[model samples]
Target: MQLSSTTSGKAGSNPMGEGAPIVYVVDDDISVREALEALIRESGWQPRVFGSAQEFLSHSRTATPSCLVLDVSLPDLNGLDLQQQLASTRNDMPIIFITGYGDVPMTVRAMKAGAIEFLTKPFGDEALLDTIRDAIQRSTTALGQEAELQLLQKRYASLSTREREVMALVVTGLMNKQVGGKLGISEITVKAHRGQVMRKMGATSLADLVNIAAKLGSSCGN
Candidate 1:
């Protein structure tokens, strides 16, 4: 199987040997599954092939960077239906659809549902591999953002209620005096809570604290 020039250059760049990104293939056809497995492995990704959507769904998903190469027609649930099932649970797992009998509406629906690429077989090996690479890159980015958000949430959870109150106020450009007035506390107490919020949230400056609050979606209560 010939890889795209882009795939060739990137195939050897993966530094995570045993923990390489996974490319899942869910197709009823044995031949297509085997072919994709070889190409995916050659391109330096772990390939997990399933004969049906149910089999794929049964597999335990890890938090590794990964994407799915799904055939539109499956023995059980169709690819689009499977995509729907995964939408809420696995937003980080990008999907690339492949089928020999693709249609305009099918393509539109798949793309609308956030599929990375929809290829009708016999698509070129290069195209499939290239799309898989792009999907994996997208998954990597999404997973990173998710992990960051989770960590941020954990840090936010660690704050005392007073510190959270101070953060909500401080990030909204409130002075310690104003925050204290709003919360019915002394300015010195507000300053102490603000310092704790900054330390707990890992914010070096007020601007940094503001950004963190925005990400946390904290409503600065009046």
Candidate 2:
């Protein structure tokens, strides 16, 4: 189930590119959804409310700065189940679970699954708002990092196979002659390939290139 009002509305769209934050509410109770929507809107955020976990899943989400205000118990899929499902995807939206029947074990499980908060019902409004603000900040930072990593991946992918080998040995503190010996190539050819790697990666210095190589290697399981 989904609230008809929210289903037809946009939540995270910032048409002007001004970086607006979105709050997604998934709860079985209509009153809870409306209350969260009112609070989020009053705080200058865009809120989209859903009456069940499955309804929220059906909605398309973006890589924008956003967080989920989820109820632990839903009519369709439960909050924890939805979290597990999202774990298999690339979704990085911060989650804050609200439940009237919260327990220590449930809180631990949710936190272990990367939920920002697990608040019991009848919680203070100020507390929830503070957590939401923090969650948004984290989401923004996470999205920025994701974008940076993607750009680095693209840059790394532009390198030729020889250039990649050159980068690997160069970052290991190997001299050009040593790299050439390892690859059974001339020292002059090694220098040329090193220069190409630096140029393609937009690295200004050997140290910078080494750092970039380290980042790509760690991410690529090298």
Candidate 3:
């Protein structure tokens, strides 16, 4: 059988749009895939179904909030293997595993690997739907944090060498005079660099700068 990605949603809606949340269903069973596609579409999510792990992996990924409804047993790579791969590469995407032969150790492994939920086959529709909802919420939060970090890094990169030095010392509770002494510069020059750092980093106050520094993992001694 031909394996490809198919999106399920309203007729005119673009499921791959930036704001639309996508749910991926990777199950070898055609009946299961069909059922999930209908369910996800009805719940106002875009459903992308694939017949195997490889097919799903080959599909291009979008940055929007998403969760995977993955079957534990697939034709190419098993669900556990797929989970391990995604854990390293796409940690922002939450996973909910569905399996017919789920056992204690299998469920434990999946959960320990950061899977949001594991459901044995014959699970209720509401239970799976609720888990998907929670997983998407987590994905949304992770994506937001990742975007924020990228913006912070961009802003930090725009700093001059001296401004970076000043910021590093300022966040370490050093006075402007002390920073100037460390850098062998005048206090007025240090203050100027500090103001530039604040303006470029969009920090409103010293405390705010410190917080941003912490988030950026700015090395104090650098």
- lDDT, candidate 2, equals 0.81
Q: Write model 1 residue lDDT over 99-139, tens digit each, in one string.
A: 98988999999999999899888888888888888989999
Better of 1 and 2 by TM-score: 1
**Candidate 1, run of 10 with poorest lDDT:** 4-13
- Quote the lDDT for 141 in model 2: 87
Name the regions of candidate 2 deviating beyond 4 angstroms.
Answer: 1-18, 218-222
The TM-score of candidate 1 is: 0.90
**Predictions in order: lDDT:** 0.84, 0.81, 0.85
- Per-candidate TM-score against the hidden true structure: 0.90, 0.88, 0.91
lDDT of 3: 0.85
Candidate of highest lDDT = 3
| Model 3: residue 189 alpha-carbon error in angstroms | 0.9
Model 3 vs truth, CA RMSD: 4.3
Model 3 segments more than 4 A misplaced:
1-18, 218-222
